[model samples]
Target: MAERIFKYVVLGGGIAGGYAAREFAKQGVKPGELAIISNEAVAPYERPTLSKGYLLPDSPPRLPGFHVCVGSGGERLLPEWYVEKGIELILKTEIVKADLTSKTLTSAAGETFKYQILIIATGSNVIKLSDFGAQGADSKNILYLRDIVDADLLVETIKQKKNGKVVIVGGGYIGLELSAAINLNNLDVTMVYPEPWCMPRLFTAGIAAFYEGYYANKGIKIIKGTVAVAFTADSNGEVKDVKLKDGRTLEADIVVVGVGGRPLTALFKGQVEEEKGGIKTDAFFQTSVSGVYAVGDVATFPMKIYDELRRVEHVDHARKSAEHAVKAIFASELGETIDAYDYLPYFYSRSFNLSWQFYGDNVGDTVLFGDNNPASDKPKFGSYWIKDGKVVGVFLEGGTAEENKAIANVARIQPSVESSDALAKAGLSFACKI
Candidate 1:
């Protein structure tokens, strides 16, 4: 069996892994000292673009285009970038076993890797219908998106089934975004979910109203309070229809399921401490085991700002946490100290010339503001989550870059409000003034 050694190893080449590699280079690493092991054939690229621009019917983005750092407005890191930095890109290698005590990782190909410090950025896997015993879930053209391979397959199927009837199961980020993406392809799109509204974890009813309305305006059909209980396939073994729990069957040439994701933590399950379905980490992204760190979707780190432990799966946290982990590691080696990670949760999405950004937590009473009319010539709207008379969270749609920054500032500052009605009346001005 082949064996390799490195001063640092980042497992999983996704957004976090790419950003971590960039940080390592920035902090100055010796050639051949660092390596990134990934199961993907390509180096790490922006994963979010998979469900967004990559699915666009016209002039879709292809890789080398949406690579790391570029997603965050920094220099794009191509596969050649790793070659230039002398950082090994162990592509198409899946590590099936990880021994924290031995500081070793074993790949499915029987290769072994040893590292002084390990960054666990394995990220998450999609929740599949087959996991729930949905009949015929394995039928062709029934898809879920989590990685580049999955995205590529979806794109290929979209072409093979042009202008197909698509039944999307789930109303969260992936489902909503995928619906819009498939719709843009001129496909007949219908969304089905168990919840009364979309993005129940984040979007309030008032917030969901605008999107549901807008989707309706775009000719997208939505069936709420129901879910796909099973699937039926044609003789060719391709999914032809979706069977709903509500005794309704919908003709579907294609089906996309995006219920949720589970962090990939099985490799280190018994070797490390885990919480909230992820590896527990300190503010610096250091795991319970020294020399082993976890970031991105697989990390449940302390939220210094909220004074609690939390796992953030978004790309923003992934980028920031990975950078923070590398900086902490370098500081510790130099016998220096750095402040704990103080993260202000941020999330955003874009589709059909519409964009929205949310910052901070999404708890407490919410006040919706601005023109949310889906039919408006220019629909601009926002919502604020107030707790203890202070703004704890803010969501804004159709916000300019400057306006988005202002709302983010408000979320971070959590400015106090005298009255909910007054604050609503003040609207975007309240955030702009702050």
Candidate 2:
């Protein structure tokens, strides 16, 4: 058979690939000129929803509703959008071999395709307990959430294990969010993490205190200073309990692991430079090799704000970097230039009717602001990170639109703070003024 050809091909059909394809379409696309290779059966939808509203039984967002661009508050790009734009979407296909030198990709079935330009957006893979040689790690009902299929499995398992005991292994966003989802389902939930506080990467102790306490009030058990070392399975090959590193065991009808993730960059190994465990790229998301780019969780690019190389694994970067990569491709073709991506790192999570938004880096001395009493009827809290005598980051819980926007602006501007105490005293008002 003849080899398939495309002017441009985007690998990995998650948020990054979807957004990149949208950008390509926006610029212009002739029939069969562009294609998106995704292992997912459906077109790209907001992946974060897998843990949030998608878990809700009532009116959960299904496919086509939460497609790409919707997360950016722009026009949703459904599967039909691809057809309308004359863009080919190769779904349920996995490229087993990639040859950067020849600009060729071979599918798992041995079909070959060639591209003039390529964008890599494979994202990441969940770090499984199996990687650590945990006993009974492959037991049934022990789940993870990374893609729609995983979410579907979790939802199905929730029904089969309704009102059951759930042991959440890890206290990051995945564990925290899933805790709420399972708890709301009336399942008994226990969270175990080996960190001093939850979200140690972003939330300071003071910041984490509010959430930990809030979760406590929600009737979820919190176990810190330890991790799930092994799992116990029942006669039916379903997870029955979790053994902790601290020599404690807890009954678990369902186990969900969210320890962390490793960037998916094995396919392009040795083809391009790698750093920070991700494919190295410039501010424009162009990889070390010309006509090839990497984005999303797999792209480690320069952060001009911090004057360092950083690889961010959040949805915001996933969407922005994809757009940037496509824009950079179009620019190169048209002999035009655009400003580099100056991203102010942002992350957020929502659980149990409580939401938080954070902006900029979470480094330096953190100052807590607002009341953090989980018992309070109206709980509102935030934190600011002051680094180099400037407010480098802002975190606010239960912020309104204008209020959230204020914190974002503060993070982007990084206003100087005379002192941590003074900044704490200024609080939300200080951010509002900015």
Candidate 3:
């Protein structure tokens, strides 16, 4: 077995890993002290792009263009960026075993690495239909997007099956975004989900109605109240049709399932305290195991704003929590003080020239505003979550930067609302003033 050592090691080269490495470099790390072990062949890039620009038929974002930090308008950390900083980029390396107590990780190739500090940013894995024992799920062209490999394969399949029928299985952001993308490619798109409406986790029925209608206007089919149960593959094992639980069969040239994701915590299971289907961490992103940190989708940490422990799966929290972890590490080393992480849940999605932003918790009674007519030109609308007369969350679609900022502020400050009527009447104007 090969053996190596590093003072700091970031496991999983995703958003949290990349950003954590960047923070470590900023705080100062000597040559040979920092290393990033990743199963991917390339350096970390913006994963959110996989469902968006990367799927675009025209001028898709290429590597180094959408690297981490670039999404947030920071310096793009290309492979050379690590080289220049004397940070080792151990790409295409998968850790097969992790002994947290020993502060060591063994790769699939039997290579072992010891670290003084271990950042567990392993991220997540795509939920496969096979996981549910769906028949014929191994059929070819039955794809799921998670990493660049998955996105690239989808792109190639799109080219091979241009103007073909695409059945997107799932109504969340992935399904919605890919529906728009496949439609833009001049293909027939049909979305499938078991929910009454799309994005039930976030979108209100009112909000979903607009998108459902808008998607219809875009010539995309929305099949709600059902799910894909099995797939029919051709003699070549390529999926040709999708069998639905609701007894509706759809001809599908390509099927993409985006049901959901589970955090990558199996390696640390029983070795770490877990909650909410993720490794539990404090505001500082430090796990129960000393010197073992967690971030990104795998880290369920305290959300001070909500006064409850929350696990944020969005890219914003990934970047922020990674940097915060590094800061906390260095602070402890240098005997300095730092504030606990206080994060406001922020999520956004863009598709078919329409964009939306949401901030804060999405609980409580909702108040919808603006025109939600799917066919209207420049249709703008928003919603507010009111709990005990205070706005707990804000959602705005087709908002200007300034307007989005205003709603974000409302979520941040959580100002009190006198009445729902006044809040509705004021609408965007209400947030603008606040």
lDDT of all predictions, in order shown?
A: 0.94, 0.91, 0.93
- Model 1 lDDT, full chain set: 0.94
For 342-434, candidate 3 gives per-residue lDDT tens digits of 898999999989999999889999999999999999999999999988999999999999999999999999999999998999989999999
Task: Give per-residue CA lDDT, model 2, range 227-331, as digits (tens).
Answer: 898898989999998999999999999999999899999999999999999999998988889989999999999998888999999999999899888888888
Off by over 4 Å in 1: none
What ranking emerges by lDDT with the best candidate at the front? 1, 3, 2
**TM-score for all predictions?**
0.99, 0.98, 0.99
Provide the lowest-lDDT 10-residue window in model 3. Answer: 305-314
Model 2 CA deviation exceeding 4 Å by range: none
Clashes of 2: 0
Alpha-carbon shift of residue 226 in model 3 (angstroms): 0.6
**Cα RMSD (Å) per model?**
0.7, 1.0, 0.8
Give the least accurate 10-residue stretch of model 2, judged by summed lDDT. 56-65
lDDT of 1 by residue, 36-119 (tens): 999999989999999999999899999889989899999899989999999999999999999999999999989999999999
